[model samples]
Target: MSVRPIGTDDEALERAALRDRHLDRARTRGAVEDAERRHRAEKDAAAGEHGIHDVT
Candidate 1:
């Protein structure tokens, strides 16, 4: 495989930056979804303890 010299390619730098940004966004989204899921589960458990039924 041929290795291109770093700091000499503008297009490669831009593509790498874009890829990093996309990965960061995906990680953030997954964290948020996980937090929401845990919160919902806890809320459901609490309601169940009190004999409350979720309508939705």
Candidate 2:
């Protein structure tokens, strides 16, 4: 086998951590979007039951 430097493992770990951060951000964004959609749907339903229309 060939000899390798000691810092290679650290580099790999850093890359993995960066990737995890990106994935976390993406998941958080998706959750927020889903929550907003649900809130909007509920609001619209409530407005409809009261015979209200959105002016904007």
Candidate 3:
């Protein structure tokens, strides 16, 4: 089996780190948005069951 180094240069390492950070932020944002969406859906459903329509 042949093994290769993960990064060849400092620039490559910096770029990879930046990309990872961006991905982490994106994942966090997505999780927050998903939670917000679920909360809104549940709230709307609860209001609907009580014969109330949320205008907002």
Candidate 4:
């Protein structure tokens, strides 16, 4: 059996942690965009029912 050096382990762990953070940010951005779209759609639908709009 063979074991890798400690420096290599640190580099691998750091790379994995950075990747995980990036993925988390991407996922959060996507969720936020989806929520905003849903909210806007609902708001527009409600406004239409009440005939209230900027009408530009």
Q: What is the lDDT of every predicted structure here?
A: 0.87, 0.88, 0.88, 0.85
Q: Cα deviation in Å at residue 23, candidate 1?
A: 13
lDDT of 4 at 38: 93
Decreasing TM-score order of the candidates: 1, 2, 3, 4
- The RMSD (Cα, Å) of candidate 3 is 9.2
Name every residue pair that clashes in candidate 1: none
Instruction: In candidate 4, list every pair of residues with a backbone clash.
Output: none
Q: TM-score of predicted model 1?
A: 0.49
lDDT of 1 by residue, 1-56 (tens): 99867665887889999999987897777975787889999999999999999999
* Best prediction by lDDT: 2
Report the C-alpha displacement of residue 1, candidate 2, in angstroms.
71
User: lDDT score, residue 31, model 3?
Assistant: 71
RMSD of 4: 11.0
Per-candidate alpha-carbon RMSD to the true structure: 10.1, 11.6, 9.2, 11.0
lDDT of 3 at 26: 71
By TM-score, the best candidate is 1
Which 10 consecutive residues of model 2 have the lowest summed lDDT? 26-35
lDDT of 4 by residue, 1-56 (tens): 99867678789999999999987887777965787889989988999999988465
Span of 10 residues, lowest total lDDT, candidate 4? 26-35
Q: Give the per-residue lDDT of model 2 (tens digit) for 1-56.
A: 99878678789999999999987887777975787889999999999999999898
